[model samples]
Every structure is written in structure tokens, then in C-alpha cells.
Target: MRVHLGSDHAGLDLKNHLVAWLSEHGYEPVDHGPFVYDALDDYPVFCLRAAEGVAKARAAGGDDLGVVIGGSGNGEQMAANKVEGIRCALVWSEDTAKLAREHNDAQMVSVGGRMHSLEDMTRFVELFLAEPFSGDERHVRRIGQLDHYDRTRELPPLPESAIGLGPDA
Candidate 1:
């Protein structure tokens, strides 16, 4: 798998470590980076490129994924999701990492550099890369709703139980 990576100064060390780890683990890692650290560097600049790389590679039928890193990973996740057709998940644990791929079919993962130890984050990424989407009917349906909304800006109707409820009810 091709893994695209990006990060701000806060995550530069972790991102750099991941690049070497990924290569040793037999995955192609693409670095969309600051190259040299600048304290004022923006996450969006690099994260968007990583997300775009995954989106373009997937569109071309390649099995590609992305990782974006920052101090809290929140902004990086938001930036990644702004790219069309990109499902970026903010992963903080093993379960979240697995669920991001299995349930949401996320192509990109965001990690908080300041939140965990190197080993913990590395394990999370490993779990994310190893998991596969479930492709269950419910998951597919939900994902379809999201994709439709992304394309059309149309909201899915409320569930039947909520249809007749008043605002106060």
C-alpha cells in the first residue's frame, strides 16, 4: 500500500519516524512535508496534499492511504476531510483506528503527536493499515448517505420514528 504522510512542526518527528518504519514494513510512503521544521508551519498545507494524494491514487485504482499529524490532530483531520472524496478519521486508540477503516472506510488517519507515546501511535497506525472495510449493508448505506450529501448538499430524511415528533417532543 502507498501511504501518504504530512505534518506540521509539532508532528515532524513522528511523521519522519513513520516514513522509515513504513518503508521497512514494505509499504510505499510518500512524504508531503515541511522538510525542515518551521514553528509557524500550517497543518493544512501539508495535510491537504497528503489527502489529495490518497484521493487521486484511489481514483486511479491504487490502494493508497494517508496519515496526517499535528499537535492535537483535530485541525489536520478537518483539513483532510475538506478534500472531495476523502474520508479522514481522527484516531486516538486501537479501536478507533480499526473502526475508522472497518466502519467508515477511511482513507486517511489523523494522529495527535503530543497526545501519546511513539509506540502507541505506531500501533494505532498499524492497526488502521491492517484492517479492511466490513462492507456490510448498514455500513455501505451510511457511507452512501454521506457521499450523497457530499456531492449534492442534500440531507437524508429523518428516521421514521422521528418524522412526526415536534421540537419539544
Candidate 2:
């Protein structure tokens, strides 16, 4: 798989480890910068570009994935999702990482620099890389709606099937 990685100064160390690990596991890891870290360097610049790389690769051929890391990972995911066609999911656990790929077709994952041990990170990455998106019709429809929103800047219309049908509705 073609995997892109992006990290801020806070995540530089872990990112380095992940790149090596990915190579050993046969993934092509593409670095998106913070190559030489500065403490004040922002996560958005690298994260956005990483998402772009994956998006570009997917457009060129098959799907490509991206990983973005920062102190908390929240801003990194936010930044990655700003790019159109990038479904970025912030995952703190192995389960969430797997689910992000399986259920959301998430092309990008965000990890926190300070949240987990190296072992945990490895587990999360392994599951994320292994899981495949379910691609059920509902999931496909939902992602399509999101993609439409991204392209048209339009609010989603309520589905007739969804109206007044929830537990509280």
C-alpha cells in the first residue's frame, strides 16, 4: 500500500519509528514533512499535504492511505479532513482504528503523540492497515452524501426514511 505520513515536532520521534516499521512491513511510506522539526512548526501544513498525497494517489489509481500525528491528533485530523476526498479519522485505540477503516472507508488516520505507548500505536496501525471498508450500500450512500457536501457546500437533506424515526423523534 502507498501510505503517507505527516507529523509535527511533537510527533517526530514516533513518526520516524512508524516510517521504519511500515517499510519493514512492506508499505511504501511517504513522508510529508516536518523532516527537520521545529518546536513551533504547525501540524496543519504537514497533515493537509499528507492527505493530499493520498487523495492524489487514489485519483491516479487504487486507494492510498495517510496517517497524521500531532500532540493531541485532534487538530491533525481536522486539518486532513479539510482537503476534499480525504476521509480522516482520529483513532486512539486499535478497535477505533480498525473500525475507522472498516466502517468509514477512512483514507487517513490521526494518532496522538502523547496518548499511547509504542506498542499500542503499533497495534492501532496494524489493525488500521489490515481492515477493509465494509462498503455496504448504506455506508456507500453516507460517504457519497458527505462527498457531495464537500463538493457542493450544501447541507444534507433529511432522508424521508430518517425523519421522525429515531428513538427520541
Best by TM-score: 1
Per-residue lDDT of candidate 1, residues 1-73 (tens digit): 9999999999999999999999999999999996998999999999999999999999999999999999999
Candidate 1 clashes: the total is 0
Query: What TM-score does candidate 1 reach?
Result: 0.97
True-vs-predicted CA distance for residue 164, candidate 2, Å: 8.0
lDDT of 2 by residue, 1-169 (tens): 9889999998898889989999999999999988987999999889889999999999999668989998888999999999888999999987899999888999999999899988887788889999999999989888988999889989687678888877636
**CA lDDT, candidate 1, residue 157:** 82
Predictions in order: lDDT: 0.96, 0.90
Q: RMSD for each model, in Å, please? A: 1.3, 2.6
For candidate 2, report its TM-score.
0.92
Relative to the unseen true structure, what is the C-alpha lDDT of residue 32 in candidate 2, on a scale of 0 to 100? 91
Residue 86 lDDT, candidate 2, scale 0-100:
92
